[model samples]
Structure formats: C-alpha cells, structure tokens
Target: MTWWPEARDELARLWVEDTSRQQIAEAADEIDRVLAVDPEARGEPGPEGFRRLTIRPLTVQFAVEEPDRMVIVVTVRLLTD
Candidate 1:
C-alpha cells in the first residue's frame, strides 16, 4: 500500500510512539474498510475526482484512477490539528 509522506510518517510514529495495540488495530481496520469499499459511494468527491473518507480521528484522502485500476491514498490526517 502506498501512502503520502505525511500518512506514512504518522503511521510510523504511531507504531513507534503510541504503543496502544487497540488504537493501532482500529486504524488498520479503518484502512481496510476504505480499501474494501467502492469509494465513489463511500466518500465525498473532491476536486479532480479525489475522495475523502472520514474515520474518526482521521481523514483519508484518496483518488481513484478507473482506467489504471488504482486507488491512490493521497494523505491521512487528524480531523483537527
């Protein structure tokens, strides 16, 4: 799975710094939920056809390229800074 730099960094930080197995598991579940869906119906569409999916405490930004059969996760972030 590809992740934007921020998302990658955050996940890495969580794994190393947070150390809460439940929280990490929940986040993983959220990621799997997003990947399992037909995003067009699951998330709000954004500019250039990007989609945003909110999983409590975090928002996942992604884009789907139909022809290429790709779901590119653009970023992941908290609901608020």
Candidate 2:
C-alpha cells in the first residue's frame, strides 16, 4: 500500500524560513519517499505507536494509519545543542 506523509505546521514553517531551509526540504522529501514504501520497517518504534526517524540534522516522529494508508509526520526538529 502507498502512504501519504505530511509534515506538521512547524516543520513546514522551518522548510520555508529556517537557515537550513534547503536541508529541511530535502529531508522532508526523503521522509515522504521512505515512508511511502514500508513505514513499519523504516523507523524505530516509539511510545503510543509513534516512530522516530533521523535524517542528518533533523529527527522526525511519525505514525502510520493502516486504514487510511497514511503516515502522519507529527514532529520535525533540528538537532541543536
């Protein structure tokens, strides 16, 4: 089944205005691709059915909805000190 992944509002904002805008966009693209195929196999399972995946300077939390074939990317944040 195909999956539709959506980044949350804050993450989308980061894509447009953050200094690491380019990288954030690229990471979101990759998240869509990876989650599309086999979401269950991609991220490490987290609490309450959420999963976490890290791509470079960002880490995203996502959940798969089997009935809707959707992947909701609930959180995306830059890894900063």
Candidate 3:
C-alpha cells in the first residue's frame, strides 16, 4: 500500500493535531480495505470526481488512475455534519 508524499504528510499532520489519531488510523485502515476490494472504485463521476470512501465521520476522496497504477487522494477530512 503506497501513499503519495502529500497525502502521507497530511495524514501525519492530522494525526499530530487530532486527539482521535487512533480513530483516524482506523479510518485509514478502512480505506485500505476498500482499495483491496476494488482498486477501480473511483467515486461518483463529476468534474472533480474521486472515490469517496467513508469511515464513520471521516471522508476520504480519491481516484484510481490505472495507467499510472496510482491512487490519487484529493482530500482526507473529517465530515462536520
């Protein structure tokens, strides 16, 4: 399982500031699970489409571009609502 440098750094920072780091870690693990199940699961199509996988209150938006064999995570954030 590989992550882009930016995503890695963002997650690291999230862990640093968020008191619920463990929860976020679990959410990340769930994202891995979704990836394992469907590497091609790009979320709802749109102008800026990405695979939207959620672990409870957190939302992970990403896209799987096969040619490069990369999971492009556009954003990882906690859902306020």
Candidate 4:
C-alpha cells in the first residue's frame, strides 16, 4: 500500500484542523481497517478506473495495480454535501 502526495496532504490537513485527539484516533483506526483488507477486496468500483472506500466524512480514492499487487491511494478528501 502506498499513499499519493494528495492523500498525505489531506490527512495532514485533517489532523491540523481537528485538534481532538479522539478524532485522530478514530480516523487512524478506520484507515487501518481499510489497509488491512486484501487488496483485491479493498476497493469498490469507482468512476473511470478508480475505486473508493468511505470512511465517514472522508472518501479514500485508490487504484489497484494488479501487476504490482499494490494498492495506490490516489487521494483522501472530505465528502461534498
């Protein structure tokens, strides 16, 4: 599993903006749950060729590169209303 720059930035931004340690813990737990999944089972079909997982207010976008057997996290962002 690998995180793209945008995913890292978004996670950083979320941590900075939300000072509650509990919130951070929750997010971290959710992220870990997602990561622990088998790459083949991790993603649900998404637009174009991507796949996505929902973690509450955030949506984790990713792509499965079968040849490499790796999951590349494309981005993490707040869900729009």
Candidate 5:
C-alpha cells in the first residue's frame, strides 16, 4: 500500500526562514515516508475529511484519498522556532 504524500502551495510560506526551512524539509521527508506507508493509522482525525499530523515544530493537515493513492497535505504550520 503505497501513497503519494503531496504538499500544497500553502505550505511554502513556512519554508521562508533558513533555519526552519531545513527542519521543516527534514520533517516533510519523514512525513512523506510515514504517510506513504500508512496514513490512516497515523495522525489525529479532524473535521471535514481532514487529518492533522505534527512533526515537532511543524504541524500539517492532510487528507488521504485511498482511491487515488495520495495524501494531499492542505495546510502547514510551525509551532515554534
């Protein structure tokens, strides 16, 4: 069961800072790996078909489309520095 985890344009803003960008990028990579393997088993469920996942300073909202074999990440946020 492979899934393609995609980040939306809305997440680009969080990568502006050099420091945060590296951290976020690393986290994003890990996110893709995890989501690709098993998205439904992870993350906290949210309303309106959205799911929330937090990787340290980054929090992301993604929706898993089983039929499409994709996890569409809709939003991203940095919790701290």
Candidate 6:
C-alpha cells in the first residue's frame, strides 16, 4: 500500500501533543481507504493540493505534494446553523 511518511508523522505528532490519537488514526484510515480505492480520487490540477474529504462534523483536508506529502485537518469548533 502506498504510504505517506509525512502524513503519518504529522498524525503521530498530533497524538504526541495530546490530540485525539483515535480520531486521527480513524481519519488516516479513512484517507488510506479512499486513496487505495482511487489514488486520483481527489486529483488536483497541480502535483499537490488540498482535497476535502467527507468526515461528518469535521472538515478533513489532505495535501499531497510529491516528496513531502502531508495532511492538514481542520475541525469544526462550533455549529453556526
């Protein structure tokens, strides 16, 4: 399976910082699943970019750049509506 070292490390660092490891792990799993199914699922115009994934109540974004892949996650702080 294709793996992203930076992404994995980022998640690990988040866990180290007392972030929800379970949540991050779950998200990573989901991301892996999607990528496995279709590496080009979130295909962007350039070699790297952010692709929003459906992960209820939270906004999960992944940035994939060659030689330095990474995933940036932004969670919803509050519900406006």
lDDT tens per residue, model 6, 24-79:
56656665666554444553333235565654222344555455444333221211
Per-residue error for 75 in candidate 5, Å, reads 0.9
Give the candidate number with the greatest TM-score. 2
RMSD of every prediction: 2.9, 3.2, 2.4, 2.4, 3.5, 6.6
User: Which model is ahead, 5 or 6, in terms of lDDT?
Assistant: 5
* Candidate structures ordered by TM-score, highest first: 2, 5, 4, 3, 1, 6
lDDT of 5 by residue, 1-81 (tens): 222233445456667754677777888778777778678878999889888988877788878886875777777777875
Give me candidate 2's TM-score against the actual structure: 0.78
Q: How would you encode candidate 1's per-residue C-alpha lDDT over 1-81 as one tens digit per residue?
A: 356777777766665665464666586577756766676676787767778877665667777767754666787665443
Candidate 5: worst 10 consecutive residues by lDDT?
1-10
Candidate 3, lDDT over the whole model: 0.69
Per-residue error for 15 in candidate 1, Å, reads 5.0
Q: Cα lDDT for residue 78, model 5?
A: 78
**Poorly placed runs, candidate 1 (over 4 Å):** 14-21
Minimal lDDT window, size 10, model 1 = 16-25
> Residue 23 error for model 2, in Å?
0.8
TM-score, one value per model:
0.66, 0.78, 0.72, 0.73, 0.76, 0.47
* lDDT on C-alpha atoms for all candidate structures: 0.67, 0.75, 0.69, 0.72, 0.72, 0.47
Q: Write out the backbone clash pairs for model 2.
A: none
Best by lDDT: 2
Off by over 4 Å in 3: none
List the candidate 4 regions with Cα displacement exceeding 4 Å.
19-21
Q: How accurate is candidate 5 locally (lDDT)?
A: 0.72
Could you tell me which 10 consecutive residues in candidate 2 have the lowest summed lDDT? 1-10
Better of 4 and 5 by TM-score: 5
